[model samples]
Target chain A: MDKRAIGVFDSGLGGLTAVRRLHALMPQENIIYFGDTGRVPYGTRGRDIITKYARQDVAFLRQFDLKSIIIACNTVSAIALDLLSKENDIPIIGTVEPACRRAMTMTQTGRVGVIGTAATIRSGAYEKYLHKKDGTLDLFTQACPLFVPLVENGRVHRGDVVIETVVKEYLTPLKDAGVDTLILGCTHYPLLEEVIGDFMGPDVTLIDSGAEAANLASTQFDPNEGTGTTQYFVSDDPQGFNQLAELFLQEKVDVGAELVDISRY
Target chain B: MDKRAIGVFDSGLGGLTAVRRLHALMPQENIIYFGDTGRVPYGTRGRDIITKYARQDVAFLRQFDLKSIIIACNTVSAIALDLLSKENDIPIIGTVEPACRRAMTMTQTGRVGVIGTAATIRSGAYEKYLHKKDGTLDLFTQACPLFVPLVENGRVHRGDVVIETVVKEYLTPLKDAGVDTLILGCTHYPLLEEVIGDFMGPDVTLIDSGAEAANLASTQFDPNEGTGTTQYFVSDDPQGFNQLAELFLQEKVDVGAELVDISRY
Candidate 1:
């Protein structure tokens, strides 16, 4: 049984949601996480920049012996996954395809709503994967650009009027389209599930893309008996990441984080 | 007669406010501006990272034959100005000192309020400069972390509900302190002048830090007119910057923009 650590990374702290999911699915697998807090919110950036950053992120993770890499950032998954997968042999998993597959199965009606960062929505990666599975599926996509910052700043509670207002602004059109299954296309979006759920009402089923990808990764690997450990690395100062990481992961990152000059990779 | 272009750069499009000021103050001076759009919002990042990014930004601008360089971003000015000044023989101007000097003159009650990004506020650069000028002056500082994103997203209108709510949340304490002059310490804040002015009322005279810096830069330079022209460069794609640039500049950037991969420099 190969037991090299799984490398998971995001533009920022949101990827910890995927780590949380992996913990539930495979408790004995080692995880190495890198968050590019120095240059974050990849959702708003251009495609080339995202690809370059993703390449750097993967290269940084490759410093350690890694069996696989999981791109927990939806923006990177949408824009840079194919190129990144080809660059390395370690089976790279993106948060888009597995999520599309789950949404395909979960939908009662053919209608599916997708909400994510501007780049993720713009990439049309989810639609491409969803259409590949079933040609007849009706897809709706919305780019909620401000959601990441709102969630990152801890404005994601159930009753935060500001967040609720923003949720309504983004989800009302999707709700009106009568989509039965909605994909929380960005990992950070799941943090606002309560507010999103309240606005979308009980009829729509929301899929956490990061969690689905984590589950897919867990199923692909063989779990080892060694105690599961998490190592955290960030491009920014460790203190800032440590402070905000609580909002993303259920458990404290057992291994304290260290700073890395991500540009070198 | 100095005819070389004056180089000004910011973490993002916000620095265009300074360019706008320069255009008005010295109509016959050629200007070169670089915005690190791919890695924008240096205000949220750590000091060393900001310094590194600022150095790269300055280095990128140095590609042009520049007479002087303006640190139009308050975060960079607050954290990286001295280092950048030491590194370059070109006269380096920062936003903090100019704005503080203006506020010292504008405040009748000696009660001044400052609002900016977390890094800018944390640097305490404004307070330090202001205290050095007049030790008895009262200062109230608040870090409005969300303002940059809100402005960048074009949510800066006077009656925009989201921005108004956030403005109240951030400025109420400053108002309560009975401050007569408030410094719009970050360049982006000037875009929200209407909303901020509405919230603070006419009495709280707001000092635009970027404008002050631009004015300072304009005063220092001797203008020799062939023809005043503007050239723009960005770390990300030119298309994205071109799209959002109208929000910052009074007139269209006449020379258009070119993309530069900032990491190389």
Candidate 2:
């Protein structure tokens, strides 16, 4: 019954995939999205830094009257979600938990493969969550740090030679580990699903973290209450946000992003 | 002889290549390097945002009483170097002009290739500089935006299938044009030189922009006059900065980096 906007933030434009889902599922609830375009690819960074940045990101979004906050960046979700949830008053949902739940439902062999930034892999969030869901599940983890930059730079296409090459290299280890299900651990990894799909073959199921988070958000919030509008915000450049979002959403996003001084938060 | 440290700044660790060259040529000069690792990958952003960030980066170094400043980022050099030079009293040198000069000298067939970030290529600074030097030089330009991310993520080695594939895709047009000399217009590109070299074949000479900038700086300043001490500073994550620099520099960067709040500048 709440009409307030749901706040969502990511390291970069990959969160637009979540925004797209929110828009489709909750057309009546307002959405606030912030992409830290300036200081992106948070997955490669250290835990403390990611936590610090995530705090700032959430604090910035808090300036608006947000009902809930979504930590759309997987690295942040893995390392800082609990800290953020404990610190903030609003319901802070990270993509990790929701995506892990979805992965649990989709796995057949109980062997799950997870790919994300180095920090995410190091955190072992996916393995811990999958094991919690099913004690018998075997987890295979691979850190694909290059995927974020590749996606940000508009190399998400299936035939993109660079993406295809990197995907193969990243997936080979997990493929050899004989995992039946693969989790695109980072929000940005969904954009490379085609290349990843080709590398893992048809047998492996690809779980999109952003999509899972969006689905969870949809279940929690009632969409038919009112017409929900999306407001975009960025810490740095707002110019390329729309262009980058187009790749993820597969549609042109006309949303005008306001620039926010995230450091102030 | 002036003994003040030369200030060098980049969006991130890519500038270490310039620092590496400076260490080799001017071993005695004290160097102050500021990597905006917290808010890095300035290439894909807009000119105004890049200019603003570049100014803040320069200001951070100014606090150290620097003798000169090197704009190691190609996007900054291409778009904001002149603006920064006007604003600062200290001598400011950028990679663009020196790299362009070096490219002009190395191109044997008049057909020259330029590869950099999207913003760098869009600015057409190298093309303008090349034409200014010799109007007859045929310039071929391609924006290899993912190269920086690949380099930063430690995917730069030769025969690394991912980097090699990306290099081949990015260099195909220039290779088809029979470019005799290719300018690695961004500092990060130098890290991927091995893969770039393999893709471009042995005939094409690769111009490392950061190296040229260092050589230019060396000619103007005597490294022997300083204390040979180097200090590293970053906007966020000093530990990540140290690790990335060590990885990129291919040696232990003994100088500890201080985390400074760069947004203030």
Candidate 3:
């Protein structure tokens, strides 16, 4: 049984949703989370830059004796996970494969809709993974570039006009395709589930990638071995991250985040 | 007479607005622009991180024999201008001082409104600069955090429901305060001028800080010194910047952007 802490990182606080789920599933496992708040919103950026930042994020976590590393960010997972897994010895798992697998099981109609940042949708990572599992599976993909900013700005309420308008603009195409299973392809996308779900109607099943990834991590480790310790680290102002932590985790972050100069990595 | 190119940089393509204005005011001036596209949107980040990025942006421009340097991004101008100006021997000018000066001359009622990113409004740089100039002047400031993302996503058309809703939400406070002159404090705001202008109505004179900064730069040197050459540089994928350049510059960005590894700075 590996007793070491599990390392998790995201472009920003969105990864904490995964951590919250991880805590629920494996209460005793020690978790160390790093949010790259300084250089965030990786979904809108280029693949190479995201990959570079992901490497730095992994290196920062590698300093700790981690049982495993989770790429909680969908953007990093889509763009950098293979490179990171190949380069490092530690077990590195990205959200895409786990969540795709979850969707494959959840979908009865073989019709799946994937929504994420531009790079993620453009990379077609989710579709590729799903196709590899079953070539007959039908996939519809949409890039909701503004979703991250909307979520980050706390505009995810049920009746928010802006959120509703933007959501409709992105999801209508997927809905038109008659996709029964919708993948919240970005970590931050889960925060806007209520609005997205309302638009997609009650009949459609919404898959939370971060939560699925957490569940995937749960199966890999022995729950009885850990100490239940959790620490938060960020590359920007701790004060700001501390204030926004609750928005992501759905509870006040117990420990104040410690700031680290991530550029050093 | 300085024959060297004038340097201008922003966290992203928003500074191209300043470059566009510079081209108009001084048609013959050679301009060198650097947009940190890899790590754009510094306005939402902490002061120290903004300062660090501003330094790297300046250092990248300093490599060329520059006649002067312009901090076209309002966030960097608000947070790092004074520090950057003091640290470097080259003439460094930020948009705040020039825009504030312009507003001073334009406002007949002495009531001025300022709108920008969270960091810019939080820093109170425009208010401080305006107050320092005339203590009796009344100022109303609002932080429009979503504006940058909206503009970057190309949601700037007049009567666009999302743009109108966001504009009203951010501008109503300023409009209620009865400010006749409004300062588009951030460079990106100028792109949404039509939507913003419609919301504020015809009487409220909108001030583009970026345009004003370009005018200010034009006055500092002889027009005949430059050869009408302009070049663009970015920290991330040039192809992405190349696609978005026209949105900011109004015209085609001739000679595609050159990539620079900004972390070295």
The clash count of every prediction, one per candidate, is 0, 3, 0
Candidate 1 residue lDDT tens string, B144-179: 999999888888987677889899999999999999
* lDDT per residue (tens digit) for residues B147-195 in model 3: 9999999999987789899999999999999999999999999999999
TM-score of chain B of 2: 0.97
The lDDT, on a scale of 0 to 1, for candidate 1 is 0.91
Each candidate's TM vs. the true structure? Answer: 0.98, 0.92, 0.99
**Residue-level lDDT tens digits of model 1 in A232-264:** 999997898898888788665544789999889
Question: DockQ: which candidate is best?
Answer: 3
Q: Model 1: which residue pairs collide?
A: none
Q: Each candidate's DockQ score against the native complex? A: 0.76, 0.58, 0.86
Q: State the displacement of the C-alpha of residue A187, model 3, in Å, after optimal TM-score superposition.
A: 0.6
lDDT for each residue of candidate 2 in A191-215, tens digit (9 for 90 to 100): 7878888888999999989888888
lDDT of 3 by residue, A1-265 (tens): 7789999999998998899899889888999999999999898888888989999999999999997999999999998888999988988988999889888888889999999999999888998888988999999999999999999899999888999999999999999999999999999988898999999999899999999889888888877466798899999888988988888888755658999899999
Instruction: Look at candidate 3 and tell me the lDDT of residue B116.
Output: 94
TM-score of chain B of each: 0.98, 0.97, 0.98
Which regions of candidate 3 are displaced past 4 Å?
none
Q: What TM-score does structure 3 among the candidates reach?
A: 0.99
